[model samples]
Target chain A: MAAIILLGLNHNTAPVELRECIAFSEEDTELALEELHERTEFKEILLLSTCNRVELLLVTDDRETCVAEAKQFLAEHNRVPLDDVEPALYVHEGADAIRHVFRVASSLDSMMVGEPQILGQIKSAYRTATQKKTSGVILNRLLHRAFFVAKRVRSETGIGDHAVSISYAAIELGRKIFGTLEGKEVLLVGAGEMAELAVENLIRHHAGTIWVANRTFERGLELATRFGGRAIRLEEIPESLQHVDIIIGSTGATDLVITSDHVRAIMRRRKNRPLFFIDIAVPRDIDPAINRLTNCYVYDIDDLKEIIDENIEDRNREAIKGERIVEEATIRFSQWCDSLAVVPTIVALRRKMEDIIDEQIDKTLGGLKHFSETDREAFDRMKQALINKMLHDPTMFLKSNGCLGDRSLYLDVTRRMFNLDNER
Target chain B: MENLRYLIILLYLASTVSYLLYLFIQKDGFHRAGIYLLIAGVGIHSAEILYATVSSGQLPATNLYDALSIAAWAIALVFLVIQFRYKIRILGIFAAPLAAMVTILSTRLPETPIPAQNIFNSIWFIIHIVSVFIGDAALALACGVGLLYLLQEHAIKAKKRGFFYSRLPSLELLDTTGYACIVVGFTMLTIGLITGFVYAKAIWGRFWSWDPKEVWSGITWILYAVLLHERLTVGWRGRRAAIMAIVGFCVVLFTFFGVNFFMKGHHGQFTTF
Candidate 1:
């Protein structure tokens, strides 16, 4: 029988500071994974390191040995005490471990459930393990099945629909005003992390025209270069604003940059087509009074935050569907594990019984039963019937009850009562 | 013949009631009832047209109002035919209102015997009327789908979750349907216009009179023509095509009723004359 052990921490278990400590830089994650695999007890290991989680997928024989090895591996790498890591860690074994892996890979365990990137992360890790030749029969099968299950959940349910992050919320808000983002222009303000994320969300939605504007022009250039967008300086924003249908502002300015006057001028040039302005800045970079203008819609940080929070609630509503999928996969995996566990015992018992039957039948018929043809035929029939009747009940009972872990005690009792021996 | 005419109106009213029921509560009983109501209405409409033609020795398109009402009924009947073929039950969401409006108005018009007009004698009138109704039917179907597409798309992008997640088709499928309808509609419309040219030359003694109805009809044709070209050649699907289809239908409705209601032209007396 095989067992899996999962040990990881996520947004729920750890503070941001702690989870950030173990977080791998994009360039460093592969090397880190290779180093983590050096533990003797961690035979087949996959490292699922993401922004919100750092899970170790291990296929090991002994639960306690594997757990200790995982804790030690993390402690040594981060230079943290093992005791300090305990409170922030979770340890799930056997059926629980398999379910956790599926959930994590499917993004059901993500801070934002159904984020869609975790499945790719899981696939990358699986490929790395395959390249290293560290994966065996069980893990290879488990992971391949996990991909299908992940796809099933996505195709059958709307768990992955909608955006939950501040960036995704901005993109969604833009879509509401625009009705569609195809070929629509987006003016991203101040090249911040939020702006970069907004760019990601917009690009994914097929918004083609992206303009990045920042106070320090290089920062804008850097983000624009990454996202294939046009970079603009703050002074050039008014000219940029006239062409763009959407504007996302999250700058470090102490005062407002876009006033009612600037907006009125932009609206006049565009002939009153709809414009969506999102202000993600703290202390508000865009003038709040501009919302009074017709055809100009403005949402400040709090307003955008409310939408993001609502997305989180929407995710919770869909999680009920995701949970149903995970629960079904868990029960099936557990049954397979239990059935696998009783296989050796069943094989050993059958081999022992056959040997005893062979010895007695040979001794009785090999020489002493060679009297007449009818007598010899009768002896062979009796010998076969006894063996058939002997093995039927035990085999049937072992397979079904074995899957539930209840057959182990009975097998032990049978072994003692029959005096089953390996030397035979 | 009289019974069939009355039956057409009855079936149209039944369809309207059932569609309203479907809108309020989307259950199997209402959906099935709507489907049966539409099928029955189409049958009655067809029977009434067939009986009127057979009894009076009159072509279906005898006068302007007779032609207008017949064209509207043909559009509804064609939509119902497609619905029966595809079993596309969602079409009732838009089709019922169209059918009821056409049938109810058909009843209100003067029941005076209309002698066959000289314009209705030309072969172009048949093609023009058939093509126009065919295109109108496709546009009506597209509007039905556009409504569903927006509903599904909104539910998804809003992060709001529930049964809508399961009921709606993918955005890709909706896009394909929208593009397909516009293409079919545009082809029929082009033929309708070409035939209208021949019919105008035959009866009105001119190739381009620029009647207000004709002007608006040409504008309507150009709107959908550009939409079709954009969708097929430029890959305009989903949102843009949806918006265009909706706008195009508004133009069609105005061409059907607005010009008839307000403007005085060859098409103004569409239902009264």
Candidate 2:
């Protein structure tokens, strides 16, 4: 039976300094994987190295010696001392290893739980492993199952649906109001860092032409040039409102920059198209009263924070559901691994029985050739049925849960009794 | 034939249950199950109506039972089309129950016997009934979309992030869907009223009637027309549009049911119990 082993260090176990020293670059990872496959007893090897975590998944017959060798190899490859690396390294074997892989792939084990980038990183790592031909049947099946479990967790739960950051919350809220930000015009007010970040996210959503308004003309022009948008004086914001559908306000202004009166007058001219105001300023750049206007929405910094906080809670709750999916997938994959153990014994026993039956049938039929072809055909059928009936109970016994506790014991006894090993 | 009607009701009921489950559980499987069940129900209901019309050599909606059945079928059919177009599966929470309720109500009411005068054979009458029922179905969907718009809008404005915020579609989608439904409904209603006038002229020897149904249909038409006019000229959209779509549907319901049940008119004779 092959033992599944996972040896790794993650953000949770090691500090950034230690992790950086131990991490492998893409080229280094491929080289390390090849060296490990050649030098170690590991039959299948996959090395996953991301900024936050580095994990080595291996399938081997000897667990103890292979794990020690892997640790030593990691120390030598990264030029780090074995004493420093050993403290941060964690090891998982058997079903626990499977569960760990599932959890990691699904983002439950991420430093920031439910972040989506980890899955992509793991996918790329798996792609490299497959490209190098270092991953075999067990590792390929395990990684594929991990990807499947990740997808199932994504669809079945809201783990990745909520936005935990301030800028992301703005985009999320914009989506809730506009359905799709595509082709929606955006106006950036005062050129604050937060507002620029929100604009960056909006541009990614394919938001149409951006307009920048600032207190100073030069700064506004520079910011507009950076975004490939037009720069306008602060007074032009009201007139610009006619075309702009989204306004992101993050200024140092103490007073409200966009009063409800300015928006009310422009709304009719704009034909009552919906306007979304994201106020990221501390004292509030847009008026709270604007939120009450028809076809207008205003969300200030505090409101965005509240949404992010609520979403974080939602993600935490959904992560619990995700963990359950991971658990179920882990149990299923482990059962498949367990069933793999019995296959060789079953095949060897069947082959041995068939060989003995074939030898007996040939000798008996050779002597009875003088009788008739019909008699020979009847004899062949009887011998086939005898093999099936004779091997049925032992095969079932080896495969069934009745021998699950001592499955290896049953396999060993059956192999010795049939003398299956020597026949092979 | 009656067993087929009962089966349709059962299918609609199952669809309604599935949609309600999807609303609470937010599961894709329940949503898919609801859609398939609704399609089946609509399919069988269409066949039943076609069978009735073929057997009688006239439109099936000559009586109240057949009219309600056709109305329910039209609602489900229109909803299915909208669902496919918009991918707004959550709207099924409302559309399915409404379809199921109308279908069940159709079976409970006693169906009036067909009139002997053969007025139902008029092509104008058939066109009018088909157009009116389909129009009402579109209006009904608009009402459902309107309700969803208000729910999502309130959730966003209030910043509550409650049960409906994530479950419902975006406010803009709901608003746009409502607008599309109203446009289609308003157009069909206009055609229905025109054909009805033609039918009235042929049978009653006059193009205009002061009958309760006629008066109410005219009122419903004017209401939607004003809404459409304002939407085009004055930019009355979003919340106002959603509210108007809902209010127009109320007038549509009154024209459809209230006029027939409470007031006596020439149209009542066709649908009389």
Candidate 3:
């Protein structure tokens, strides 16, 4: 196995104060990458510096020495003493390091397990490393495989589905109803914080028309202008409801601001088009009875929380699937590494056999001076057949089982028998 | 010729299995291989038909066996062309099995060819048979697509969000393609009916006969006409249009097979089965 050294401190292993101290700035990272290439014996190095974690991934021939040197480099670069930083550092070597890289790229180890930003952060780290000439063939293949595993985790499981926050839940429910928010209209019944949050999420999903109505006209105008929507008076809510498909209400009101009668009239004017209501206020602003009307749906604060809770649970379940995918990809990548390791031996053995056959054929043809063209062809065919039959079993066995376990002794004996080591 | 027909059946079977694999796996490799296999089957099928036609000195669609075989071939050919035009690869999952099933049924039919001196051997006879078979093939494909639409709709409505939900094409694409199939099928059926009327007048000295095959074909044609009319005028779409397509294909199948195999008619009486 190749030597992989991963030494870093994340939010899980270190306090925020220590993480901030250990984090690499852009200049610090570029200098460290350059210094490691110039001074250290490590073959490849990548520094991933984000707010939540600062990790150094190094590939070298000697795992123990490289892991120690990488930690010292981190300590010296961050201006921290070696003793204090060593206790905070977490180290993974070889296959564990590979798995860590995969899990990190797939976001399985993030503070938010299924968050999507970590993959982009890792990609940028890899891009910087590649641009600096710090990552070569091995690290390049490993990073690309990590990216692929992350993509597989994204598609094969519903890890990125559903919403983890209340406002996002409201938007996700809107998506479930309309399949997309691209052409749907949203009505913000008040300028409350949760309603504003919902509006932000709706805008992110590309909702078309937005109407903000509130009891206070100036406050409504401020919120509407902030979100690029129309500011309507409180009395105009009913008329706006006829045109909007979704209503997010979070006003601070004692009584229901939107009644079943108001919605019934709007429903009639809208000609029975579907309507969705998300009320996040205490003593909800919309009538609960309006939910029973045809093509009408109402979800209050508790319901939105329930959906978020379910979504978190769904993400946890999906994370388990993601872990399995990571393990599967890790095994595949390990096998590829193994095959790469044995390729040199396989090539040397085949060449040795071919060279011996070619020498034997040359000597025999030199001795047969009176042979006809057909006779010469027959002799060449016989020599080729002898060579193929002799090398077939050994070639198949070594190519298939060479990477199984410690078989260096067998490779050494074969090299000696063929005088390959003597040539070198 | 018989051996070549058998080889064609084997190739069709292989293509059908490959298409089934493509559907279940949803892999591009499986789909590409399935398409290649289907093309191979079509090539062998054309060769077998050509051989039969040359040896008999007539069109291969002279009996129930050959007619059904030609129908299957045309269906696969048209489906291949549509698949290339639209890139609706899942269409083959339905079309391949249909072609295979028709060829299988053709094998089970009697092998006796039509008599040489049959009065229905005119060019009008060839036109009527070819047009009607191609039309029926299109309607059958439409029926298959309609079934796929209903399956996808059911999956979405039930919120299964499973394989079928993700794998099936969009509802709008399926509906539009089904509509296109009906338009082409209906046009060909109109031509087939007109040619049949002309040939009937030339031979039986009448334009309209109360033959079971003719009457049922008229009923099938009228059902399709009503389906098209409703789709154009009343904005029939989605599930309603899908159900109509399936029902129209059912009527077509009854006219093509039930009338020929069970009832007495000028069309059925001529073909030895």
* Winning model by TM-score: 2
- Candidate 2, DockQ score (0 to 1): 0.75
Question: Highest lDDT among the candidates is held by which one?
Answer: 2
Per-candidate Cα RMSD to the true structure, in Å, reads 10.4, 6.9, 9.6
lDDT of 2 at A38: 87
Error of 3 at A342 (Å): 18
Give the winner by DockQ. 2
Which of the predicted structures, 2 or 3, would earn the higher lDDT when compared with the native? 2
Model 2 misplaced regions, further than 4 Å: A1-5, A27-47, A56-87, A126-145, A155-157, A328-424, B27-29, B54-57, B60-62
Candidate with the larger lDDT of 1 and 2: 2
For B50-139, candidate 2 gives per-residue lDDT tens digits of: 888888888888678888899999999999999988898999988898998898888887877675467778989888998899999999
TM-score of each: 0.61, 0.82, 0.67
lDDT of 2 by residue, A1-424 (tens): 6789999999999999989988899999999988887854777889999899989999887899999999998889889999999999999999999999999999999877789998999889999989988887778889999999999999889889888889999898889999999999999999777789889998899999999999999998999998888999998999999999999998899999999999999988888989999998888899999999988999988998899888888888999999999889988888667746788777777777778878988886677658687877787788778878987887888778796443555665676677765735
lDDT of candidate 3 over A1-424, digit per residue (tens): 3566788988888889889898888878888899998855577889999988999888776777778788888888889999988888889876788899999999899887788999999999998899899886668878999999999999988888877888887766665455568868888887777678788888998998788888889988988888888999988888788889989888888999899999888765675556889889888899988877655678888877776677788889999999999999888766555544445766766677677777877787888788889987787687668767877776676556563432433454466577754545
Supply candidate 2's per-residue lDDT for A403.
Answer: 64
Candidate lDDT (C-alpha), each: 0.72, 0.88, 0.81
Clashing pairs in 3: none
The list of candidate 3 runs beyond 4 A from truth reads: A1-4, A11-22, A31-45, A59-88, A102-120, A126-424, B50-58, B270-272
**B174-225, model 3: which lDDT tens digit per residue?**
7778888898899989999999999989988998999998999899999999
Residue B8, candidate 3: C-alpha displacement in angstroms: 1.6
Global CA lDDT of candidate 1, please?
0.72
Please identify model 1 stretches exceeding 4 Å from their true place.
A16-51, A56-79, A131-134, A176-183, A188-191, A196-240, A252-256, A259-273, A285-296, A343-424, B1-92, B95-119, B124-273
